[model samples]
Target chain A: MKEQILKNLSNYLELLQERFGHEKIWEELLISVAEYGDSDIYHNSIKESLEKILEVMKIDEVLCALDIITDKIEGFPKEDLLKYIIYIKNEYCLEKENNLREVKEALTELATPIIRIWHDIVLTPLIGTLDSERAQAMAEKLLLFIDANKAKYVILDVTGVPYIDTVVGGFLMEMIKAVRFLGADVVITGIKPDIAHTLVKLGVDFNNIIVKRDLETALKYVINLIEKR
Target chain B: MQERVVPIIKIYDCLVVPIQIELDDTTVEKIQKQILSEIENNDVKGVIIDVSMVDIIDSYISYTLSETATMARMMGCYTVLCGIQPQVALTLAQMGVNIKGIYYAMNLENALEILAGIEE
Candidate 1:
């Protein structure tokens, strides 16, 4: 049985190389096939091999490879082969989803970081688009940071942020108010022209908040404020 | 029966009014009247309305506070609102109630400092 399975696998591999002409696919097939031995292990190894093949080759090509092997091996159940194909497809999709989730979480962590630039001064540099969810997460994180650090001045530098909508603007206002309640004054910097226009059109009142044109000016103002204190 | 009056403590030329109780429409009106009267009687330069102890402020109270500030300004008394809790500010902002043109300080000490600066 082992010798026959090995012979059929070699034929399928040759056919795949001839059709795809990809060295990577052959390497993946070899690794997946290495696990082929006992009945239970063989079933799992076949599923893995199909997944790797589906990644590089089309489903029709995989089916053709299975057909070639089935003809040589007597009593090779066609239903079992189809079931393995379905299982591999589902596993591949699940893995892709998990990878995407991990990347999104990493990006969120990288985008919002509260740095204590000076004594009594905390700076949160926002990057990417300020969506409502990210804004809320940022707000919660910032409030906790201000309370823990006893921050007197918070500079929300939006130089890295590409744009802000009305929902995000509301979130930012709430964040500013919460920070103020913690006895910390908040300064919003790097308001781009388009974003400023959007905010105005949205009727977001900036009267209560201190806004600076750039980080440099904000830093200067903070320095003067600390000095005065 | 006499109306409840919000106490106004005279600290030099600055009138310090600490709002220790929740304000209804009548109480807000009474406080406004008391503050304006104190400002007029003593020729106070600044009025500090400390809302630090007050937990909640509805739109009516917010409107009254802003109106009182404007009234005090008309009487030549600068008004400083001090010690607004974070939750109160957030709630007020969410309710679209803003007291613009009124100065805000983090605490009574900062409020006094701001008043002193304005007096100079």
Candidate 2:
């Protein structure tokens, strides 16, 4: 492949130069094909050209480039060229997936923290929409803290949460059930009007678990219970 | 399978059961029987079962424990489940396994305190 590319290098340059207008990228692509056609440098060169081409040129132009190189250069395997481009595309997709996974992991960590707020009471601020996985995680961590600290009350503040549908409401109930079984009462606060409207209209009962308007009222109610005890 | 006996240390009127072995179906049943018999024979006031060392407690084992607690309750003795590992508790919570008729305390000390309060 290297020998074939070197043999018809000048002709290939002329064809690409006509289409690409004497750009330095064509020279880099040619040298990489000649010296390290099967190596990582050629891989990077092909990747760079595709990114650059996709930036300014249309997809048809790219397809035209593919046709030009494969036809103009004698004995050049189109499969090998396709292999490089496909591999580059696969790597790009995997890189994007990896970044997405990292972002999800970070969001989960930040979202599900059960922090101690007051004596015999721990508070967890529920941010983002609630799902089964996140609610299960938050419940697990909150239960442990309640046991370890012997917390008598759990205050779930949903101030940052944007929405809570019926399914999310069920998850919330499950978590609340688990907390109560541990001998701790759960106090949920900070329901938006739209969420409260939906929750009541859906017949999702907050009658069992104590619901307060805000964290301050919830804390005051807990304190009142503590003193009454 | 040979049944291994978990030691039941009598601390005053309350019995302290520290479960140090892996609990299979047969072993769990056997332990429950032993605890019930020990409670009856000794006229124990309260029972504190520490499960910090036990890694897993399935639905059946937890049900058996709850049954034991209920039975003990009828016999005028309280049962306090102590030191449930965080992971085990999470599994139980996620499974929605409600352990009725038993009080849960974080550790042995808390368990003893619960016993003292119950006896009073």
Candidate 3:
């Protein structure tokens, strides 16, 4: 009976390995969160990525599952970990995969019946991690959006962002540059104190990217710029 | 039946092709050739390409895209690159690829509006 139990454990280990191929744990967690309500393509990738993370971390199966599932949820219940097992398993088995591709699709998903709001004024709201990949995508989208809309002013609100590194900071500068090139003024908002300190420490110059304390102030600033123009 | 031949949506009377993958030399060439042919065969005023599907575009691809837009304009067809991912835009900016004079839109719908306004 002990040997049989060991044999079953080995089989389970193999299954876990197969699920996560090569992705990191954090990526798996993030991807899982994103893919929670998506299709099979996304669903499988998240599972596989998570599985790989679990194996690489060499975490206990039960504990690993608990952690990943909790991370996947926006607001995980702060109850006993055991009590959450069923919920975790349900989410793990049923949730879809959320990958970079899905995010891209989501960004452009606003294509139908296009918002023809006056380009004479524009607002490009940015949210989440301002990593290089996401920054570039946002820059391109905003520039094109601004040019297409012929907006005189573009407002970039980063209130939802947790942090900004050099690469991302540089991307913000790029957006300002592109917006100005298209004859539009840019107003930046949501300058968190920590983010400000990080930027200063990086020795990066935000001398040009117009910044404001919050979205409300930035909105007012943008309105002033547009009116003047 | 075979997959339906997607209708060529008209934007500024130009054929706006929505790309569904990363932009590489080969894909850009394929798109360029398609645009050239469409320009010659149809009264395409411009091309608005949606590249949000593209996660990464190397400098070479960026160059080609810029060149293609210029070529389209020279051929009497304006080009608009729409729905570029924000991150991609940042990279392009760092690399100093001036995608100027090339109309850009946040999405296909926005692209269409830009093209339509220009058409009017």
Candidate 4:
């Protein structure tokens, strides 16, 4: 069983290399096999392979590798398989999240859509700690959802968010810009006092995003804004 | 599945219930059973659901909390949620789970004050 599993992994690697190109396969496919293949291969083999690939790989290469592994092994229990995938995904998320620092410097380069008004979609919620990358992702996702649904307004509620920094503050402003580009009004709600103080200390301007104390107020504002428009 | 220790204490005629767990379905069921019996047994005028220890609050848990508040109100008991984690509160808010009618406080002591006010 052990030898067969190694053979199968090598064979699968060969196929992956042929189909996806060696660099793509090497970066992406290697992690999945090492993680989920029959419980025969030595852990050392997995670690050594990972270490060699990681040493020279770019951030994108590592992210691609994680994505591939997550796609392939998501079905298995995290205890059994997905743990490694999650570890890589978290690393990828953190890496990309950190990459947003570069984006903050090039804030003018950010292409935020015009806020459009859609009467159909009821509410839009923004969850997760809004780092620049996650904020950008959320902004883009919100725009897409608004445009696709012709949503009249979106509620950007951040009450569940634990903390925010200067980068995240800028990201929120960028999100407001993006939402505006989609012709949708975005109501920013759930601003806890600590985050509000952080925004003030960071010297970030939220003049454009409509502010509300909480979701109920945001929802009420959304309803009124939609009604008036 | 760690057992949560909730002490039922009387503070100026109101029942102060300090909850120490995530407000998920499992915890909600346990709480519902516990609080209902406690409310019936004590005939308290107010209840404080302390959530300082809860880390996560999805829509399901929010709905349960909201329902609990409603039921408490129907039974003539005021309910308040205390020490809600900011992250959990944010998620619940975005998910459109409004604990609108229920009182919210920063800590168990503050919640007790709010409940005590209602009791008096």
Measured over the true interface residues after superposition, the C-alpha RMSD of each candidate is: 3.4, 2.6, 5.4, 13.8
What pairs collide in candidate 1?
Answer: none
Better of 2 and 4 by DockQ: 2
Q: Please, what is the whole-model Cα lDDT of each candidate in the order they appear?
A: 0.77, 0.78, 0.61, 0.60
DockQ of candidate 4 compared with the true complex = 0.01
For model 4, what is the error of residue A151's alpha carbon versus the real structure, in angstroms, after optimal superposition? Answer: 34
TM for every model, in the order presented, reads 0.61, 0.80, 0.42, 0.37
**Number of the top lDDT candidate:** 2
Compared with the true structure, model 1 gives a TM-score of: 0.61
TM-score winner: 2
* Minimal lDDT window, size 10, model 3 chain B: B1-10
- Candidate 2 displacement at residue B44 in angstroms: 4.3
What ranking emerges by lDDT with the best candidate at the front?
A: 2, 1, 3, 4
Error of 1 at A128 (Å): 3.0
Judged by DockQ cut-offs, the docking class of candidate 2 is acceptable
* Per-candidate total of colliding backbone pairs: 0, 0, 27, 20
Instruction: Give the worst 10-residue stretch by lDDT in candidate 2 chain A.
Output: A36-45
Cα lDDT tens digits, model 4, A1-229, are 3344344565545644654445543634345454545574435444444554555665465556455544554332224333454455577789887788777534423322233333543354544455666665555555555545655467766777777887787667655544443334567788888888888887755665688998787777777755763
| Model 2, span B11-77: residue lDDT tens | 8899999999999988888888888888877867999998889889899999999998998888888
As a TM-score, model 3 comes out at: 0.42
Model 2 Cα lDDT, one tens digit per residue, A57-121: 66577667878787766554456666766766688799999999889777877997788877888
Evaluate residue B96 in candidate 1 and report its C-alpha lDDT on the 0 to 100 scale. 67
Least lDDT summed over 10 consecutive residues: which range in candidate 2 chain B?
B1-10
lDDT of 3 by residue, A118-151 (tens): 4366655666666677666556766666655656
Docking class of 4: incorrect
